[model samples]
Target: MLDFLNDILWGKVLIALLITIGIGFTVASRFVQFRYFGRMFRILGASQAFKHDKHGHLSSFQALLLSVAGRVGGGNIAGVAVAITLGGPGAIFWMWVVGMMGMATSFLECTLAQTYKQAEPDGTYRGGPAHYISRGLGARWNWLAGLYSVLLLVTFGFCFTALQSYAVATSVGDAFGVPVLYSGIALAVIVGMIIFGGVKRIAKVTEVLVPVMAVGYLLVAFVVLGMNLERIPDVITLIVKSAFGLEPMVGGGIGAAILMGVKRGLFSNEAGLGSAPNVAAVAYVPHPANQGIVQAFSVFIDTLVICSATAFIILLSSVYEPGSGVSVEGVALTQSALADHVGDWGRSFVSIALLLFGFSTVLYNYYLGENSLNFFSTDNTRLLNGFRVLIIALVCWGATTDLSTVFGFADVTMGLLALVNLIALLFLFKPGLRIMRDFDRQIAEGIEQPVFDVSRFDDMNLDAAAWEIEPEDLARIRQREAAAVAQGK
Candidate 1:
């Protein structure tokens, strides 16, 4: 049943839907992801992104880190290897394509997340596809929202967290001869401590770790590629040729490349999966588009930068013959390829990287689950506590057992999660575009920092607390605008 479901959902429905919706969003938004590409860096680097609000909401940068933590995980490494193994070198090219289109999909979904976000009792915010479907599309769509919440909870909150723990335990076991059981126990304990501290702690932990791990892994990749600089051209040529069926290798032709690339790319960056927007909605940005643009850049960092780094490391190695019949799958394939470049120590590096990647992802996934639980029943304290304990237990259990069947089931749920989110995005496309256009209009009018004015969107349902401007802040915005006008004249 799992295989049949996977084949039907992933092999056909999702690929077409994801591509079509992604392209539709890209076109409707006038390629906002590309048009505002440079500004994404400016938004992320601005002091506003780092500033903590009086209400204790997460800084925009912190929310970006949380989203990145979820994105830059084991998939960037082991998953890329699997793509190449099954789909050939051409898969890397298609992954880039998916990442590009996904930027627009991510932008649309996250903007809607912020626009429709609900103010929580504790002063934080909660929203995602579930909130937007119910609020943006109207209460009649509440059933669909509830369905999305359940799918997200099962796919990300529970199953994926266990899989992340398993990846970490497996890597540690391989790298240091430590038992998987021991690693699992240690991971559960550490994860419990951080999670218990709540979302703020998760944000802090990821803020420090995401940059370190991503930069560290990229540095190693650069070194490996530098050592084999002469081979760079050949690898690039191979990827392009294979992508177009010009180079027939391991996984047959263009069809395999497109399939594996889109699959693993979605898994790695999570652009349209609706998971990132859960964290994105938690941010305190002046405008919804600010967080949306920041998140689109994250998809680039995850797939184009981090995942591409892994692909290059593998393809540039002596061990990575296109038709090589060697059965070194997943992380082992990556480790073997790296070992060929930098010696036995290369294997250990991949292991440590995977461990960090997997650990951070668990934290991100746990928060998404928590957020979804809040959507169902915010007052259910006992239920929330039990859910935490359940997650820890699942992590430990997953580490000690083979969950291939369970993981396949997760794939089905994940696909369903994307399906629901993409359909909702289609329903809310015009509203999302209106928000983006408002931001662009502000920029064109010489507003240095765009601020969302809820008054303009009176026809649309929105949480005023999320977008309302204080009088003092409004005064400051006016002063800045006046100064800009005077200077321009």
Candidate 2:
């Protein structure tokens, strides 16, 4: 049964859907991901990203860290390993494609999350699929809302929780020869302590870790690549060729190459999975759209930058070989390739990285689940506590056992989420488009400037008391937009 499910997941149907949606987002957004590429890094580096509210929660960067915590985890490190092993090096290319397009997908979803956000009893704000669906989707056919919540609980909350713990335990077992059980217990304790403070604490942890890990891993990979600089040209050629499925002659064709690239991208960055937006919703950005844009950049950063770096390290390493048996599959394969260059220490290093990535992901996933459950009932405090405790138990369960089943379950769940999220975006598209246009106009006209601060409505309309946006800013942006539209005519 597991074999059959794995076959289906690794086979065409699911792949087609994932690829199609990625392309769909890329096309529908008119390649906004590419058009705005240069700004992503600058936006991330801006001090505004790290600014915080007095009582609301963490800063935008903190929220981003928490979100990155979920995303950049096991996948960036271990998941890359999995893709190359299963789909071939071509899979990494596809992952890049998906990450590129997923920017807009995440932008749309996170904007919607912010757009339809609701205030919680604790005086903090929360929003995601459920909130957006109920608001933009309306209260009428709430059955779909209910179903989405359940899916999130199962996928992001429960099943994924198990998968993350497994990654942690496996990494530890490989690195230090620690028992998986011991790793599981440690993970549970760490998660429990951090999650106790909610998203803020999670964000604090990830904010420190994400950059360190990303940089540390990249430095290691770059060092390896530098040692083999002579082979860099050939590796690049292979990547391009493998991406086109034209080199090794193993794939169906260039079409297969592109298709695989897109598949890996979506799986790696998870733009439209409706997961990242949950974190985005909690971020206090100028406009919901601003958060959306920042998140779009994140997808690019994750798949295109980070994931691609991992692929290069493994492929460029001298010991990399199909025959090496280190990467019998994905993440493991990456570990082996690194070890070939770094010695046995490489395995331990990979394991430690996975541990950080997986635990951070678990923390983020817990919040997602909590938000989903919160939509059902605010009084479910007891339920929420129990849920957290149960997840802790599952952490232990995940570590000791092979994660084939849980990973299978997560794949199915993500597809189901994409369908609902995309549907919500259907209603959300008009508003989203307006903001995209407005933001672009503001930036182009110099009225809004690059940061495009819109934290409150008054910022966009200065006449409005609270979030007073300067009229000069608004008029300048409008005039430019008109001129651009006229030029198009």
Candidate 3:
């Protein structure tokens, strides 16, 4: 039943929806993802406008790292291996296509998240598909928001945590002969320590870990690519030719290539699935589009860089056997590829890397659910605390148990979440476009720093408190209002 549902939802319905939305968003936004490609770094380098509230809110860079932490996970390693194994080298080409298109979808969804975010009593911001569905679409659509929140909680909070834990346990067990039970317990404890400290601690930890893990992994990939320099051209040609079914080695045909590419690509980067926006909304940026651009860049980094690294490593190595039905499982395939290239130490290196990737992903999944819980009932501390305990338990269980069924269920829920979010995004498309236009206009007028004016969005259902100006800026604005009042009198 789980496989049937997954086949129907992810294989048929969600794949088309993902591609259509990606293309639609890309066209609608006038390719804002491409236009602001370089500006992403500029916005990321800018100092936080609300540094005083750093404990409660995240800087743009921190939020980018948070989203990246969620994205560059076990999926980048194991998931890529699965795509290549099932769909051949052509799958990598399709993955790149989806990544390119998904960047625009990411930009739109994240901009909407920022525009509709709410300010919490603790000075934190919370928003996502649910927040936008209720707030942007008005009270009548609150049910849709509730549905989205429930699906998000189930998908990320429970299922994905398990999936990530399973990857870590399996990889570590394979490499070190560690018992799954022991690894599961240790995994639970380490996750509990960071999660208990709340989003601030998660942010601090990921901000440091994301750069280190991503760069180190890429460096190793570069070395592998460098060693196989002679095969680079052949590998590139194979990927393109396989993608189009021009290569005889690809038995799955173009349809399978597209399906696996879209499925795993979406899983890896999470561009249009409404997951990243939860974290994206936590950033303190000058303009809502600032975070949007930063997040769009994240898609590039996840697929174009990190995921591509995994693909290249596998493709360049002799361990990858095209058209072989006996290929290794995801993490094992990656381990085998690296080990074949370097040595036995390469397998251990991959195990440690998987642990780090899985750890950060589990942390991210918890926060996504916690944010959903916040949306559901802000005052229900009991429920929130209970949910955290449930999450920790799920983490341990996932580590110890086989998660084939769990992953199937997760895929179905994720599909539903994306459907709900894409519908809401379509409804609220104009506001997102308007917000982007306003930001672009500011940049066009030579504003070195573009700040969002709350008054400009008076007609929209935005939370004023969430977009309130800094103290210094507020004082200056008040003086201008006073001067205008005096002049009118």
Candidate 4:
């Protein structure tokens, strides 16, 4: 039944919806992701100025890293391997295509998240598809919001966490000869320590660890690519040819490549899957579009950069032969590719990298669950605590479970969550555009830093505590606007 559902959802429905809607969003937003690409870095650099010392609020940069932590996990390593194995080298091309389109999708959804984020009783900001659906649409949609929240809880909290844990366990077992049970137990303990500390702790840890892990993995991938520099063009040609069935390969033809590519690509970057916006809503930014732009860049980093690196490393190595009838070995394929380049130590390096990447993702996924729990009832302490324990146990169990089962369940739930979120985004399309126009208007008027004008959205019933400017901040914004106008900016 799971396989049947996956075939229907991923093979047909999601492929069409993801591509069509992603292209629609890109065109509708006037290519917001591309136009604001450079500004994303500028806004990220300026995050320090908008830092909130508020207990539950995250700085924009921190939120970016947290989202990155969620994105750059097993999917980059094992998932890429699976795509190549099942869809051939051509699958990598489709992955790139979906990733690029996903940036626009991510921007719209995240901006909506910020626009409708609620100020929680504990001074924390909360939002996602659920919040926006309920608040932006109407109380009648509360049921839809609840469905999204539950799907999020199951997908991120249990399925994804277990899948990541499984990746870590398998890699460690393959690389270091560690027992899966021991590794699982240790991972659970380590994860428990950090998750118990809550979102603030997760933010702090990811801000530091995400950069280090991503850079370290990329550096290794670069070294492997450098070793195979002469074959770079050929590899690129192979990917393009295979993607369109011009090249015969192990994963059948163009159809398989498209399926695997879109599936794994979404798994890696999760742009329109409605996960990143949960973390995006926690950020403090002068304009919601500012964070939206920043979040789009993360999709670029996850797939275009990191996932591409993994693809290159595999393609360049003799361990991965195009059209070769080799069974998919998930993370082990990636580890073997590195070993072929750098010997025994390469395996250990990949194992350690997966542990870090997967661990950080575990933290990010847990926070998504917590954020969703906030949607239901923020005061359910006992239930929240029990769920934490449950998550930890799932992580341990994931280490020893069948990879296919874990992935199948995750794919089904992820598809459902994304389907709902995309439908909701379509419904809120006009409001989303209005917000974008407001931001563009500020930018057109020569505002160096566009602050969101809450007044323009008064009828929207957005959370005042989240968007309302304080007296001093409002004064500063007006002064800046005046200065810009005087200088004819």
Cα lDDT of model 4 by residue, 460-489, tens digit: 979888875546545665675577678884
| Candidate 2 residue-wise lDDT, 1-489, digit = tens | 654654454455556554565566567667776776776555455425334444455445666777777788777877776666555566666676667657777877886776666655554677787777776666784787788888888988988899888878877887788999998998898888877677777777888888887788778878887788898787767666677666664344455455446545666687877888888877654455567767877786788778877888777765455323342555677777788887988888888778777877898889999988987998887898898898888898988988886786777776677667767766767666656776677666753333334443332221112122335444554565467578778
Model 1, position 323: C-alpha lDDT score: 79
Assess every candidate by TM-score. 0.96, 0.85, 0.95, 0.96
Model 1 CA lDDT for position 119: 81
Question: Over the full model, what C-alpha lDDT does candidate 1 score relative to the true structure?
Answer: 0.88
lDDT score at residue 250, model 1, on the 0-100 scale: 58
| Residue 83, model 1: Cα distance from true site in angstroms | 0.6
Candidate 1 lDDT tens digits, 82-160: 8998899999999999999999999999999999888876677888889999999898999999999999999988889
Q: Which lDDT value does model 2 have at 81?
A: 67
Backbone N/Cα/C clashes per model: 0, 21, 1, 0
Candidate 4: which stretches are off by over 4 Å?
54-56, 470-489
Report lDDT (CA) for all predictions.
0.88, 0.70, 0.87, 0.88
lDDT assessment of candidate 3: 0.87
Off by over 4 Å in 2: 1-30, 41-52, 248-263, 322-327, 449-489
